[model samples]
Target chain A: MSFDVNQLFDVNQLFAEICEEDNLFAFEGTITSEEINTILENVEARMAELQIDLKHRKKIYNITVECIQNLYHHSDMVPEPLVEKLGKNYGQFVLRRPGNGYFITVGNFVLNEKIKFLSEKIDKLNSLSSDELKEMYKFILNYQKLSSKGGGGLGLIDIVRKSEHKLMYRFYPYNDDYCFYRLDIVI
Target chain B: MDTLSIEGTAKTPTVRFDASKGLIELKGRSIPENSIEFYKPLVEWLESYAKEAKSQSTVNIQLEYFNTSSSKCILDIFKRLEAIHKNGSEVAINWFYDEDDEDMLEAGQDYESIIRVPFRMMEVAAG
Candidate 1:
């Protein structure tokens, strides 16, 4: 089945649907440099409206950027013929105002085989204390050689450590070959 | 000896390293898309600064959050500073963390414990 690159993702509609009032200003869209910038700006503006202080603002901004970049770099979606021709992957990000903090959700397609490894890693990270997480991060950073993207399980650890909150995750079956994984970090 | 200043972005930190003044400061968040590309020049500047460094040198790091890649880069910087300190020069590293940020404080301690240099971890009020 041939899918047109531009037709594969409706970024605007996705954003609108996810940003509804019921979602508490949550938004979802494709992963692009421009989109990333917009998300940062919007989150900052929302933080201002919510009277979030500058320090927490910095933390939220940093964590959000890291999560978005992770999706952009590691999301399981390989370029389809049309996407490759257009030079982009179809990714989504969602943000919502939850409790005393904001929750950022990111979703992307990935290979079926990767889900098990990712789930295991997330489970392990979720179970570790802050101290254990730091030790784990150090161990990974020291022993793990640099990959092409410089990731060696430390990014996820950093995300969990910085958030200081539990990670919420869900997996949706897309097809036999690909599944969509959604991860949320509250800051 | 020269100074290098790069503005911080949403995914990166501000870098100010003045070789002549022997003052290096890194602040803000760092999760750069291309960690190596962003840090290579800073590493190069430190390499040059280590040789031309006259007088006591002080490097201050005030970071709120950094990804794993930046963590490695931070370690690299500390190693360079340690080398300079070993070459019969004065070097002091002041690592500042938010008062409520125990994770950062512990991270600073981790770095301090690993590198053989005069390192001070300070807890400052969050801004």
Candidate 2:
């Protein structure tokens, strides 16, 4: 099956919807390592203007780094077909403040074949309590080899632990070849 | 051998590994996209430092924030130090976190649990 490039995930439409609410910053396009640095700088500047305490601000910033870098690392795993259409490392992220806590939503494309593993990973992370997650993080840190793409399989676990919230995720079927993976983290 | 000094950037940390004083200080953020690449020299330097045999080695890590990838590389460094400490070099790791930053403190404690080297959790005033 095939899907229109725009139909994969409408970046502009997503931002428009989020902006109408309480988005502090939003970006949708190719995310390079350099771009990640720029995005983090903007996030830090934006967070500085808020009334958040030091701990919360660091939590939000650390989570933001993991979220965006997750998108960046997963870019290589996207099927060649999707990479051609979306460009390598194409991803989007929105930082919003709705009610009391801040919301960070990061999205990227994943090959269909990898969906099961990704889903199971997130589900397992969401199932664990805070203490369990902490133990898992330490275990991975001590044991796991850092992937060539620069992930220790600790991003999702760290996000869940630091946020102290269950990770919210969805895998939207873009086509038979790829699925849009979105992670919504509350901080 | 000689001292290893690398300036910090927007995404990487400032690394200073001095062999003479047996002082290794890693300050600033450590969120480089390619953490393995960024930390390779420091790890190699530590490997060399291990052989030279200073009776005491002190490592001060005061990172404002580090990504998960960097976290792993940081652990790699600790593992090397653990080996050094096991070999009878007095290795002391002082992990500095801003006051009230429980996550950073916990991160230190986690490493302390994993590695045999003694770790001192230092709380500093938030800047």
Find the candidate with the highest DockQ and give its number. Answer: 2
RMSD of each: 5.1, 3.2
Docking model 2 quality class: high
Q: B1-127, model 2: which lDDT tens digit per residue?
A: 9899999998888989998998999999998877999999989998988888589999999999999999989998998898889999899999999999999999999889998888999999876
- Please provide the root mean square deviation of candidate 1 (C-alpha atoms, Å): 5.1
Q: After TM-score superposition, what is the CA distance of residue A186 in candidate 2 from its true location, in Å?
A: 0.6
DockQ of 2: 0.85
The CAPRI classification for model 1 reads as acceptable
Give the i-RMS of model 2 in Å.
0.8
The A-chain TM-scores of all the candidates are 0.76, 0.87
CA shift of A106, model 2, Å: 0.6
lDDT of 1 by residue, A1-187 (tens): 1223343353345446555623443444456767766777787788788787665666676677677777767753743632553235666666676556677777777787888898888988899998898788777766676567755557788778778897877666545666567787887
**Number of colliding residue pairs in model 1:** 0
Candidate 2 per-residue lDDT over residues A41-154, each given as its tens digit: 898988888767888899999999998888887765555655666677788799888998889988887778877898788888888888898899988898889999888989
